[model samples]
Target: MLDFHTLAEFSRANCVSICAFLVPANLLATVLTIILTALHRPLHQIWQAAGFASIFALIMVMHVYSWFAIGVVMLPTYILLWLAITCLLANLIAILWRRRFVNTPSLSNNA
Candidate 1:
């Protein structure tokens, strides 16, 4: 039978491993999302921007929490995540603003 301490250690190790896996996956997904947005302008609409921003923010929070919980001190990693989230939010706001205010001229005006 596994002792309490051994069980605790296993749980901690599992959490750390999961965090390690998630960090890279989240990063890759973020990068891919950015690339896809850039390559396809239509896909970079306001709603999509907001959705991506939220997803990026969620990933950053998860990474940070995981790092802290796992007792890792990757300062540069934390900074990068913060920067990515900030940029995402800014872009999302700009997109929402444009979508809300940029009205197109209606064809009825030509009559």
Candidate 2:
């Protein structure tokens, strides 16, 4: 269906199309997660987590392709995905450390 000259080109075109939409959708959700996590907004954390899970599901579905096609389509896309995941992980670690350090149990209870 795509306007490509060869079968390989057609497959790459399909991959590019799928990844094109997936990349930005993932990024926006990640940014939202970061903001929500940073502002201590737990209200939407569940929903955002679902969104993140869905993105991964989509990526896994895309992984059905052969390595050759993947190599063609997943250059900058995977890089961006890795960066987003790293940011999310860092945010989660920061949040955990903040809670632990800020709300420590009193060492010496004045009995």
Candidate 3:
């Protein structure tokens, strides 16, 4: 099958370039998410931020997986991944909560 070791080596070699974009993107997305949450903004806005963060997180995880493939275990990677997952879950729960409990009028009263 797939030669993960080779892939790991390749990723490791390019870690700097990969992280350059991911780090800033993740930071901006997370910051926006936090701001939206603090402001009590609409669920859709929060979702947008969380969605972007989650996407970046997934990409970062691939880089972390490369380290694992190469037999390099880093605690920071686990922490970062956990944070990413938590943020995504929080956003999802907010959306679900709004959809489930917040009632919207199905029809207008006036003709």
Which 10 consecutive positions of candidate 3 have the poorest summed lDDT? 101-110
Candidate rank order under TM-score: 3, 2, 1
Candidate 2 C-alpha lDDT tens digits along 16-39:
675666666655665665566566
Off by over 4 Å in 2: 1-13, 43-47, 50-54, 57-111
Off by over 4 Å in 1: 1-44, 103-111
Write one digit per residue (lDDT tens) for candidate 1, span 5-102: 56445545575564565556555655554554454445345456556556655655655655566577788557746765765665665554455444
Ranking by lDDT: 3, 1, 2
Best by lDDT: 3
Candidate 3 residue lDDT tens string, 33-78:
7777666677778777778777887778788777776577778667
Error of 1 at 108 (Å): 16
Task: Enumerate residue pairs that collide in model 3.
Answer: none
Q: After superposition, how far is residue 74 of candidate 1 from its true place, in Å?
A: 3.5
Instruction: Give the least accurate 10-residue stretch of model 2, judged by summed lDDT.
Output: 60-69
Error of 1 at 6 (Å): 16
Q: Supply candidate 2's per-residue lDDT for 1.
A: 79
lDDT of 2 at 98: 43
Weakest 10 consecutive residues of candidate 1 by summed lDDT: 35-44
* Better candidate number, 1 or 3, judged by lDDT: 3
